[model samples]
Target: MARHVLLVEDEANIVEAIRFILLRDGWSVSTHSNGATALDTIRSVKPDVIVLDVMLPNKSGFDILQDLRADPAIGNTPVLMLTARGQKKDRDTAMAFGANHFMTKPFSNSDVIDVITRLCDDPT
Candidate 1:
């Protein structure tokens, strides 16, 4: 089965880079840049995985994650939180909010692919 990914990021360069890598790796990709409507997009897209950014225009990724976890329908879908700042607080916050994995900016393409692959493969 083809895996689908929803990328919620605002940076054009980062979005392009990540989209290129993920598409090259054969995953069908959907991109969304607004945080305020990201949750709605997630519900509509129903992707296998989500790559969410920390900061957004109207809403924050942390708030999105928290809201996502609260929704029963899409709550369990794996989330990979990304941020330019690699602070321990961000990682901890991501995990505490139910992120499956957290990655800092400038992540290697292989690492992104590997993490997504692992997230989808694990049965838990």
Candidate 2:
């Protein structure tokens, strides 16, 4: 079966870009626009990896990451966190919250592809 990715982002452009990239790479990409329902979507889909944004509606990505880490069933799933603010503090916070990888917005397609490929291939 093809690998699955859950992209939790609110921006239409970003979602389209990511969806195109992942779909081209032969991964099944499912998108969730609302932060309030992101976790529920994750539970339903059980994606192989998750690409989450820092800013979102209803809930912050940090809060979602916290919930994911707290749940033993999905806690170990690889999470690649994206942030518009490239501050060291944001990166630190993501790491502290158990994010598998951290990425800044305006990211190159190749970079995103590389990170997702790595995460799926060797999700540790």
Candidate 3:
């Protein structure tokens, strides 16, 4: 089965780039821009992986991750948190919220592919 990946990011260019690369790498990619509706989209899509942005319109990525962790149905879904800040605090917060992986903006395409692949492969 083709693995599904949902990208929740407001930046147009980043969304395009990640979508293109993931599609090229044989992933079924879905995207959402609004933080307000992100959780609803995620539950409906039930993607295998999620690439979430830290800075969003209505809610922050940290809040989203926390919510995901609290929900049993989608709690274990792998999440790769993205942050433009690139600060230790952001990374720490993501980990604390149960994100499987985290990446900063301007990340290499290979890194994104590799992390997603690894997360999918990991049984626990």
Candidate 4:
């Protein structure tokens, strides 16, 4: 089966671009503009990986990451957090909250694809 990804991003244009990239790479992608809805979808879909944004409506990516880690079923799931806040503090905060990886906005599409592909292929 194709790897499935839950993409939580608020920017419509960014979402579209990332979705297109992931789809072209042969991954099934589901998107949510709000973190609350993303949480619900994550529970239902149990995607192979999550591409989350830090600035989301309803809940922050860190908050969602905390919640996911608290749940045993989703705790170990790979998550690649995307944020415009490219600061050491922000990156450290995401790591503390259990994000498996982090990427800043204005990132290269190829890099994002490579990271997600590696994460999906990891057995752990």
Q: What is the C-alpha lDDT of each candidate?
A: 0.92, 0.93, 0.91, 0.90
Those runs of model 2 whose alpha carbons end farther than 4 Å from true positions after fitting are none
Off-target runs (Cα >4 Å) in candidate 3 are none
lDDT of 4 by residue, 59-110 (tens): 9999999999898987788999999989999999998888889999899999
lDDT of 3: 0.91
Clashing pairs in 4: none
- Candidate 2 has its poorest 10 consecutive residues by lDDT at 68-77
Write down the RMSD of candidate 2 (Cα, Å). Answer: 0.7
Error of 4 at 15 (Å): 0.6
lDDT of 2 by residue, 1-124 (tens): 8999999999999999989989998999999989988999988899999999999999999999999989888888899999999999999999999999999988999999899999989977
| Candidate 4 TM-score, C-alpha based | 0.95
Name model 1 segments beyond 4 Å from true: none
Comparing 3 with 4 on TM-score, the higher-scoring candidate is: 3
Pairs that collide in candidate 2 are none
